[model samples]
Target: MSSQYRTGSRGSAKAKVIALVGAGALLLTGCTAEAKRGWLPNVERDTTNHTGAIQDLWVHSWIAVIIIGVMTWGLMLWCVVAYRRRKTDTGYPRQLSYNLPLEIFYTAIPLVLVLVFFSFNNTVEKSINAPVDSEVVVDVRAKQWSWDFNYNYEGQKKYFAGEQAHLNTDGSAGVEETLPTLYLPAGKSVTLELNSRDVIHSFWVPAFLQKLDMIPGKTNYIYLTPQVEGTYAGKCAELCGEYHSEMLFNVEVVNDAEFKAQLAKMEDGHIGEEYDRQPNKVNSVVVEHGHEEGGK
Candidate 1:
């Protein structure tokens, strides 16, 4: 009877292992194409030149984490079952004061993992932020609840000063015609110089899979080549004030002809101006008040 019970326990454990493996495989296969690639839904695999590298790093990192999790859980379960107290035992199981090798392994493994992640991230970041002889440069200025885009191409510059978004009754931002739109020529390298007039804001475009902070009195830049021609949504990722949620913009990646025509139209409309223009007074007052109170 004892031998039969032991055999049955082993079989049950094997069955459980098989079932878990089967379930994991099913879930993996059931994932959508995008989810299978990077575990993200509704996101394209590659929207810019740097997006592929970003997605690769993201997916591989998750894979490494999942592998480590499975191994750790398996070891924990083994410890629980293999070292379990038995009915025939008298006293407690032998206890070790320390495990030098195990301790060293746990420490070294995490350090190695961290180093690996950092190395990959640093490589990708350097590639993305590498300076290029860009065909176009955009000076982006962020204010209380709007954006200003100055497009510089060839010998001409075009500007667009965005207005604050319309707020719905529920306090959510509404899509309005007044929102600023930035146009870029597809397949051309462009650099965006980011700055803030009031407080810190983060320029984020989900499709680009990149975001940079706009710091007051400091300039940040991002360089990218738009590979696809389409309209993409952009917003401030940082919470600056009450209207932070209303800070929004649009990016239109069009062909060279369309980009040139848009620039001409902007020039005709006098939509934007030089960076030397005065900052928004309404937001400036708010910032000034905060500074005065802080000084007090």
Candidate 2:
């Protein structure tokens, strides 16, 4: 009996050592490997006007989550190995009914964690939705499965209305999937007023790290700044209708001179009367251009 007890104890100790070594290796691998490639592995890469601030909050949140996850998993593994049934056990191990201190610790810790997370999220949300002195305002209208972007420049109503792009009829792929391009000056604040014509739709610019819903009879606002000088993709994030997949758009961030030139060109009888202006109203006309009343 003494020999059997000694042998069983030795085996259990060896098993525990192996488990600890494996757990340590996993922790080291996860930390070093993911750290090399930015800590938050699942978040979208940010390139919007004020997305840097949001990105900071996002990274910190993920770090907190990972730390809690590791600790919780470590405790579970430790409990499994440390209090496991042994082959050399006689009748039963000493079992405690309950510990008030441990119970309170578990309950209180989670509550504190929840509050901390909530506060962090609230701060980030406020920062994202904060108002800014906008240099330009674009009224965005969603209908069926398409987006209409009306740009108001220098106190003038939409001098140019942007809609979905069309491919050349020659069957050649010239600029594949290029949709309505909304031009804005980089490093300037721009406000977008979102309104839906018929059904609900979402305006999402993944690079901007911003999205807002457009509901009928209600106007939603999205304020953002574009910092990059390239075209970024935008899309209707919500499934609205049969052609929902075709609801795609583009955002072109340009320099101040180029932005002004584009607006000037649009005002100089370039867009023509067919692409004429419209009143900026939340509950106004929702007809596509040329399909309007008595429009050619």
Give the winner by TM-score.
Answer: 1
Q: List the residue pairs that clash in candidate 1.
A: 159-272
Q: Provide the lowest-lDDT 10-residue window in model 1.
A: 287-296
- In order, the Cα lDDT scores of the candidates are 0.80, 0.71
Error of 1 at 109 (Å): 1.3
lDDT of 1 by residue, 79-115 (tens): 9999888899998778899999999999999999999
Q: Candidate 1 overall Cα lDDT vs. reference?
A: 0.80
Off by over 4 Å in 2: 1-46, 92-97, 159-178, 265-289, 292-296
How close is each model in CA RMSD to the real structure?
8.7, 9.7
Minimum summed lDDT over a 10-residue window in model 2 is located at: 268-277
lDDT of 2 by residue, 1-296 (tens): 69999999999999999999999987787667435454554233446656777777778888898999999999999999998989998898888999999999999999999999899888878877888778798777776655566677677555444444444577443544456667888888899888776677899877676788887678889888777788877888998877676667777889999988777665422222232223354244427644432111
Model 1 regions lying over 4 Å from their true place:
1-38, 170-173, 268-296
